[model samples]
Target: MRIVSVRTWALAVFGIVASYASLYWVQANTVDGITPPLVGNLPSIVIQGIGVAVMVYVVAQLGLRQPIGRQWAWLTAGSASFWIGSIVWAYYEVVLEQPVPFPGLPDLFYLALYPLAAIGLFSAVSAFGKLFDTRVPLALAAAVSAVATGAVYFAVFRTIAADAQLSAIEKIISFFYPLGDIWLLLFPAAALALTAGQLRGGRLAWPWWIVVLGYLMVAAADVMFTVGTWDDTYQSGSIIDTGWWLGFSAVAVAASLMLDVQRPRDTGEVAS
Candidate 1:
């Protein structure tokens, strides 16, 4: 009756908890209304930061091999690029356009922090995927996520931002703003869950599948919401929209942690 290390288990548990807590904070503070203050939202951002850190530490210790490392590097580099774009968008959205409290430090921090975190997450995912020989699927998923995010940026976000009526230099950034975010939140979440299953030496845990399904569901919901709001101001119907994204993200993090806890320690060979 072997048991998992307490530290490993705790990291997984707290990572999920912190992720959800951050989501709740965003729901409570940011999505309820427009003109949300960046200063006020700092705590939630901090919580997310904590969760990402714990997740990186846990996955890094899981013993991934070299090929996976290279692929993960690509993912990390792409995510960082996406987040840099996001920081630019945020500056335009919060600091430039809307007057928010404590503008200077918070703005600068978020701008820098997102890309850094993206690199960390990419490292974690690469290491985690090394626990199994499922590189093809993992690579395919990363590619698809990248393509989808890119499509959204070029086709939808850029056009909307470029409109003369709504035009701002920041809007040009709208295209890539959420691209890294979608990849970071989706692929890494799924990768962690799959890694957990492989580490556990069990029949592939269904939680990974659930995470993918939830992502699809949330994506569908976003599409529906977009259609419904076509005639209305995009900002008005955002509470539910943002809440749904955060909720699914929390669920993904929690499920991944649970799977990680249930995984067994490595024998000499990788677990099938």
Candidate 2:
């Protein structure tokens, strides 16, 4: 128990330090060609990788404390998928000595995260039993998803599809990135509905909200990446790269917060 706590603190500290270092590096250096310096790539990869691993560990610990069934499995799997995908991306940057390919093997793993995380969050919420009504939340999720999809189509898909430089496959894969985000946002919106304007069980919703926030950051980050790519202005180690780490850090914190969940005893036992 003490060891876990210590390790968690250490990882948290590392995340903080890496974040500052990354920002400082970006601010201190002028644009060095298109690729970021190793300083930027290494810290972002190492810190975020460790952070996500820690979050997975925390989720696993929570499962051991209570009967979470496969809820933890889905969340951890989703987190792990992204972490693995990041590693593959790093391999291209670090080991292969090449630019990371767009819509390459990494996309398979990255895209998988959307479905996996959506299921994981849904399972986590449902595991609370029927304590909270979900009708409004469900509707809200659909509405938000619709709006986001429309915005993404107009802002991202139309441009990518119309680009004369991209082949059909490239355009199709580019579209998938934002499309996946639209789907991913629904899980958190539903969670927001369950937690909004309530106090009793709303505490449980914090982790969900945190994950939602993380995904939101991710969505924003990806948008910047896409726009940069489209305009031929994307830099590998630019400030935009910080978004991925920060987002994952939020996810790590969310996973850690779940450690305190009492695991609802029964629907009636929980306060309304």
In terms of lDDT, the best-performing candidate is 2
Off by over 4 Å in 1: 1-98, 101-107, 111-113, 128-131, 165-169, 202-272
Worst 10 residues of 2 by lDDT: 263-272
Best by TM-score: 2
lDDT of 2 at 74: 68
Candidate 1 local Cα displacement, residue 225, angstroms: 13
Q: Can you give the TM-score per candidate against the true fold?
A: 0.45, 0.81
* lDDT, candidate 1, 1-272, per-residue tens: 33334543454455446545644565566544553545334433343344344434434543335433343333333323323433444564556865322223333433342365355445656566566565755676678787877766665665565556543533433332344346645666555555646654633444445445544544544443333333244431233334333434443353343334434453121222
Query: Backbone clashes per model, in order?
Result: 1, 0
Error of 1 at 92 (Å): 14
Inter-residue clash pairs, candidate 2:
none
